[model samples]
Target: MSFLFFTAVGLLAATLGSLVGLGGGIIIVPALIYLGPYFIGKEVSVATAVGTSLAVLIFTAFSSTWSFHKQRKVDFRSGWLYFLTCGPGAMLGSFLTQFVDATTFQLAFGIFMLIMALLLIFKGYLKPVNVRWAIQRTYTDDHGAVHTYGYGALPALAIGLVVGIISGLFGVGGGSLFVPAMMLLFRYPPHVATATSMFVIFLSSIMGTVTHVALGEVDVWMVLGLAPSALVGGWIGARIASSLSSGKLLWVLRITFFLVAVRMIWEGLG
Candidate 1:
């Protein structure tokens, strides 16, 4: 039963994550905390849940990234540059996660989820910042339309550091923030942003996973249960995303985030 539950959580989270560049950490972390005890017969602490989620993320991000790569959407140059700071930041954040208590973690995560939900609500209305300092880059989409976009090195590094820290601390892969930042601040096309975000996540999660493993914060059994399913779902999701717009999908995710946020907050208060 525990295996099945974990697998389901991984599959669902990875599918949605690949579609939107979210990396499925939001769903995995919360599910591990709220539902894990029911199936595993033991409560999973915030640190353990986060660590486990990050471990599971490796498979999801990898499969999704590879799929996106095959579709010629990933911007590897940008990904490597951002990872320079993001990787170290993830290590720092993962180490820091140990200091947070369950209550604080739940409350903080709930608030974070609510904020992410709100961001999604306003994401479509946001305009690109378009900094002149950007190192201009270009990508030709499947339709033969060339999209020009870029970001300043300093700004990109700064965003990577912050996003990486958030990813390690929350086990969320930072895609919610990454996609928006890319689209709004860097003027990246949605598909490119999402693909590149997954690439960066794949790298950062490696650093995060190492930190968590050193701290003995991960549940190896849980990761084994979740990873295979997550891999399959990630591939499926990326394939779907390559050919589809995600308008309705985003709506469903927003609702899910709202419900999960409220429940997490309520639990923390209790």
Candidate 2:
């Protein structure tokens, strides 16, 4: 029964995560932390929960990325660059987790989620600024629609470093930051940003998971229970995302972030 419940949660998390290129860690980590005791008949530590989520995310991200790749939505060059730059930070964050208590970490995660929610809500009202140092690139979507965009490589690397650290620390895939950064800062199209973010997430997650495993933080049984559902959910989510308009996708992302923010705050306060 616990396995079934976790599998269901994984399905839901993976669906939303893949749809938004978040790699499902936001949902997975919180769910494991809050619900694991009740469902699994034992208390699960925050670190263990986070590590398990990251392990499961490996499958979810891969599944989603594959779906996006099929549609020619992934920007491999940018994704690889972000992945490479993010590695060091992720390693550092994983080590730093030892110094953080569960309550403090939860509070910080809540604060971070709140900020992301606000950003998503106000994204449309924000004005765009031209970045003079941006590297230009062109991409053709599955439908042969060409998109030309520019972004500063330095800025992206800096953002990736931050995102990686947060991901390792919080057990999130960092898609919450990455997708928005690419769309708003790099001027990427929404779909392209999401797809590219997923690829980057996959690579970064692998690094984080390895660090967690070395720390003995991961729950292998939980990961096994969650992975299958996550894979299927990820594939389904990517398919749905391919059909959604950018506006609709952003709306979904905003609403989800708001809900997560509220939950995180409640948990943190408790």
Largest lDDT belongs to which candidate? 1
- Report residue 97 deviation for candidate 1 (angstroms): 0.8
The TM-score that candidate 2 achieves is 0.93
lDDT by residue (1-270, candidate 1, tens digit) is 987898899899999999999999999998988887898899998999999999998999999999999999999999998999999999999999999988888888999999999999999999998476548899999989998998889889999999999999999899999999999998999999999999999999999999999999999999999999999989989998999889999999999999999998988898
Runs off by more than 4 Å, candidate 2:
132-134, 142-144, 246-256, 266-270
- Worst 10 contiguous positions by lDDT, candidate 2: 125-134
What's the distance in Å from true for residue 268, model 1?
2.6
The candidate 1 region of ten consecutive residues with least summed lDDT is: 129-138
> What is the alpha-carbon lDDT for the whole of candidate 2?
0.84
TM-score of each: 0.98, 0.93
Q: Write the per-residue lDDT of candidate 2 for residues 64-168, one digit (tens) a residue.
A: 999999988898988888987786677667767777888788888888877877887887777556664457888877677887787777888898899999988
Model 1 CA lDDT for position 99: 95
